[model samples]
Target chain A: MITIKKPGLLSTIQDLGRYGYQKYGVVVSGVMDSFSFRIANLLVGNEENTPAIEMTIVGPSIQFHQDSLIAICGGDLSPSIDGQTISMWRPIFVKKDSTLQFGESINGARAYLAVAGGIVVPYVMGSASTYVRGKLGGLLGRALQSGDQVEIGNLTELSKKVMDHLHTNGPAKWFVPFYKPINPIIRMLKGHEFDLFTDASKNLLINETFTITKEADRMGYRLSGPKLMQKEQKDMLSAAVSLGTIQITPDGSPIILLADRQTTGGYPKIAQVISVDLPLLAQMKPMDQVRFQMVTLEEAQHLFRKNETYLTDIKRAIKLKYR
Target chain B: MDLQFYPLGDQAVILEFGNIINPTIHKQIQVVSNYIEENPPDWMIEFTTAFTTITVFYNPEVLFYKEVCQELSHLLKNIKWDEPNEYRMIEIPVCYGGDFGPDLIEVAKTNGLTTDEVIDIHAKGEYIVYMIGFAPGFPYLGGMSEKIATPRKATPRLKIPARSVGIAGTQTGVYPIETPGGWQLIGKTPLELFLPNQEVPSLLRAGDRVHFTPISLDQYMEMEQTRS
Candidate 1:
């Protein structure tokens, strides 16, 4: 069991996302940075889609009520256990009643914490992700409150082995590296309305830097940089929208839809941030500047396949180590 | 007709049938959607429809973009658009005017018509569900009478009760959930528009036709009582 001592700005349980419900207009609310969420699970010997605590810009202070093995991934929220700084991408053993706290974030905007077993929350539509707007999933269909007591699910064989190893004073230097883009540039594929924008606007989108505005949230990142006007003003029919779709509003500002975005939108989409680049965009904070680069559909597919292959290899290596 | 397939992202592609909103365009969208729903591709994750476009989301890890587009194009060519309708025309019980509809009087005054005339014109129109969006099970309906048409409220209310049947511009829809909206409410429906726990959460679907049957407030209360 885990008890939240002080719930930070925004903290909720999330997995990959709720699937098979967008046709019914249910938002697939999940961790903002799924790449980090998956890695955090992997570090603790859990499945990639295991539910974890997704902390926002600020992180909550949690106390473990039972002995557990845990991993923290994504944004560097400067986590510490009993006043000692903890590593970000490694599993550590926490004794019963030990408290974990966080200071100011040093690198990114969101962090994920994974226990050996996933968070035990009743699933709504086959996902544990909390969709606050609809009050769909997670603990009572809302963010973790300060006094919330989260139960841990039963551990898998791998998790049980990992926990037993950690209990035996295992190697202290075990860690895995997460994907971190060297440049703050998100790659994208052209949208259906890509050609509708003026040539200058298209050029500016790829060359100029856009600042993430204060209106940024789990729903979307309203970017301020170029005024990308379409050649003609036409009312678009509302269509199914997904994560990382860069929609241009009537005022011409670009908004990148994120995890908690509406299932469908009527705005003209200019570009779609590639799946491989979503992690980079997910970590961006307000006032951070980012550039966009156009990539072919094949290139985007290739990058995603490479990432998946890496993930598969890591899982195999970890299994071999346990054996 | 030339079907233009465009990339929504790495995960989804949209097949656009036409550029405008018309019954024929909507029918085309429905035909494609129905075909895919009946014979779903292994790679297809989910598919949704709009006024004239059907966007198909897929698992990119399972199939490449080129293969998906090609498969869709081939399947579209073989689709027989002429099919007997399977969906039913559901009649919704609505209590128009008075306390159930706050904007009823204002809309009638703006359109230069009596409140009863406005209600009659709205209730008589044959409406079709074009899509579900904005909120869970909130239908974007088409085919409202132009005589009852009115602009949206200048300032949207923070809370519009669920099951409220409203109009905005040329379109009519039902608010499935309590949400902030700008639509001009003319009536309230007793039937639930959205049920979250069921296999099919939404009470309506794309291509379903709906008719509004006027009922007294007593009838509405009795129906609400039976529901609980």
Candidate 2:
């Protein structure tokens, strides 16, 4: 068990998200960066959908009450143990009564911490993710606060072996894959209402750069960029919207839906960020500028599959090393 | 009935029946939704039904896009609407006017009718649940009396109580949770529209027929007590 000493910013336990509930208008709240979240889980021998703590810009200060193995992944949040700086993207053995602290983010916006065993939280509608608005799932359907005691589930054989080997403190030999984009260009596909926008609006989408505004949160990122006006203000019925959907509000600005977005919306969507580039978008902080690049549906699907294969290969290599 | 489908993204497809909101469109949506629910593909993760459209979400790793589209097309062609779908005629107890409905008098004044007359018209009209969205179990209802139709408030309230029956322009809906909304409140219901613990959280589905039966404050308290 680990107790939260300071719940720095937004810290919540999340898995892949609740499935089979969109018809009931339930939000699928999960980790912002699934790529990093999965890697952290893999490093600790946890399942893909194992619950982990997702920290935002600022990370929480935690005190471990029991010796355990853990992995920290995603944005470089400069984590330290008892004032000693620690490395990331690899498994580390934490002794009982050890304290973990984090400072300002060095690169990205979100960080995921995975223990040897997943966090033991009650599942609501098939997920452990906390949907704050609905008050369902996770640890009482809310973010972690100071004094919260989180229990860990039973660990796997691999996790137990790793923990036993690093009884005091040490890192594993298994390496972690890094995904860093050369340019801050997000690839997107034309949405259903793509043709409804004016030609100038369409051109502006690809030509200009958009800045993520302060209004951004788990729900969506309200961008301050080119005002994309539609040809006509047609009354559109509410329809299903997914994560990465770039919706143009009545004010003409774009809002990119994220992990906790509502199931349905009535806004006109111009583009949808490709699934492969969503992790990069997730790492972007407020005031970060991003350019959009048009990609075909085929290209998007190809990229998604390629990324998945990359992760699968990494998982296989890690298991081979442990064996 | 004809069905139109297009890709929403690489992961989901939006199947639309038509652009209008009517009983025929609702029936078509219901038929397709029921068929898919009864025989869902292995790759399909979930689907959301809205007014005149249903978006089908799937896992790309398990099934190819072309194959999914082909299978959906074949299913659409084979769907038979002759079998009658279950229609739930739910009677919702509402407390209109007074404190339960702050805007009831204003809506009546705007429509040039008395409060009792507005209540009578609203109660007599036949309504159907078009979709459940905006909030969990918050039904977007159709078929409200046009006479009492009013535009939404310019400024939305920060906290509208749950189960508040409201009207905004041509649409009438109930707030299943406390949320900021611009709808003009006409009455309040004691029933729980959305409960997370239930197997099916939402009380009303897309095709369910609904009727409002006016009740007093004392009756509302009695029903609330019985449920608690």
Candidate 3:
């Protein structure tokens, strides 16, 4: 069991996301950074989809009641065990009664913490992700609060083996390097209504550097940059939108849809961020600058497959080391 | 039915039936959606249907973009559209006017009709649930009397109560959750549209037929109590 001493900013339990409910207008709320979330779980020998604690700009102060194997990934939040700073992106065996805390935000906006056994939370619509707006999943469908006691699930065989190895070997000597680029250049694919935009708007999209406004949240990041206007006003019926869809609002500013975006929207979409670069966008903080680069659909698919293979390689490497 | 496929990012594809929002396009969407739901492929994750399109989300790891398109094309070719339209008819009891419907008077005034006349017109109309989007269990309904058609409020309300029935332009819908909206409210219903605890959280779905029945304050209170 782990007790929340201080719940910082917006901390929620998340798996991949709640699926099979978007047709009913249910929002798919999950960890913003899937790459980091998967790595955190993998480091502790848990499945990629295992639920973990996702913290925002600030991080929670957690008190461990029992000795456990855990890993912190995604964003460098200056995590520490007791008073000593701990390395992230690798499995660490924490002693009982240890207090895990986070201080300065060295880089990135969100961080994920994974335990060997994963967090035990009732799944709503086949997911443990917290959809706070709908009050649907996670711990009472809300963010973590101070004094909240979270129960850890029974560890899998792999997790137990990894824990034993970590207990005997202290901590892993190496870790997956955290990746966060300042002013990242996010790659995107042309949207369905890409041709509807004026040439000037298209040029502005590729040329201009947009700043993530304060309106950025789990739903979307409202970018402040050159106004992108369409050729003509056309009434469009609401259609299905997805994560990383860059929609141009009536005011001309683009808003990149994120994990908690609505299933359907009526706004005219300009482009969709590629799957490979979603983690880069996920870790961006408000007021951060970013540029968009266009990529072909085939290229995007190739990049996605490459990323999947990279993760699989990491999984195999970790298994060999632990064994 | 003619189908057009467009990519919605790397993981999902949108199958557009037509650009117009009519019964024909809506029926085609429903037929295709039902087919996919009944016989979902291994790579197919889930789908969401809108007015004229159905977006099919899939796993990129299982299939490439071209393969997904081919599978969907094969599925569409096999679908039998000759089957009769099958849908559920749900009757909602609404208490219009007074505090339950703060904008009922304004809606009547905009249409140049009396409060009772507006209620009569709204209740008598048979509406079809075109899609469920915007909010959880919030149904975007069609087939309303043109006489009572009104534009949305210039300024949206910060917090419209749940189960509040409202009209915006030619469309009418019921709010399943308390959310900020611009629709002009006409009444409140006793039925709970969103049930988060149930296996099927939403009470309404696309292709369902719905009608509103006017109820007195006393009946509204009695029904509300029974439901709770």
Best candidate according to TM-score? 3
Chain A accuracy of model 3 expressed as TM-score:
0.99
DockQ order, best first, reads: 3, 2, 1
- For model 1, the stretches where C-alpha displacement exceeds 4 angstroms are A181-183
Instruction: Estimate candidate 3's alpha-carbon lDDT, on a 0 to 1 scale.
Output: 0.92
A1-323 per-residue lDDT for model 3 (tens digits): 99999999999999999888999999998989999999999999999999999999899999999989899999989999998999999999899999999999999999999998999899888999999998878899899999999899888787888889888877788999766688889999999999999999999999999999999999999999999999997878898899999999998999999999998899998999999899999999889999999999889998898889989998998888767
Tens digits of lDDT, candidate 1, A181-296: 54478999998889999899899899998999999998999999979999888888788888999999999999999999999998999999999889888898899999989999
Q: Is the docking of candidate 1 incorrect, acceptable, medium or high quality?
A: medium
DockQ of each: 0.74, 0.76, 0.84
- Report clash pairs, candidate 3: none
Q: First chain TM-score in every candidate?
A: 0.98, 0.97, 0.99
List, in the given order, the native-contact fraction of each candidate: 0.63, 0.60, 0.78
Model 1 TM-score relative to the real fold: 0.97
Q: Could you tell me the lDDT of residue B93 within candidate 2?
A: 87
lDDT of 3 at B4: 91
B80: Cα error in model 2, Å = 0.4
Candidate closer to the true structure by lDDT (higher is better), 1 or 3? 3
In Å, residue A261's CA in model 1 sits off its true spot by: 0.9
What candidate 3 gets wrong by more than 4 Å, as runs, is none
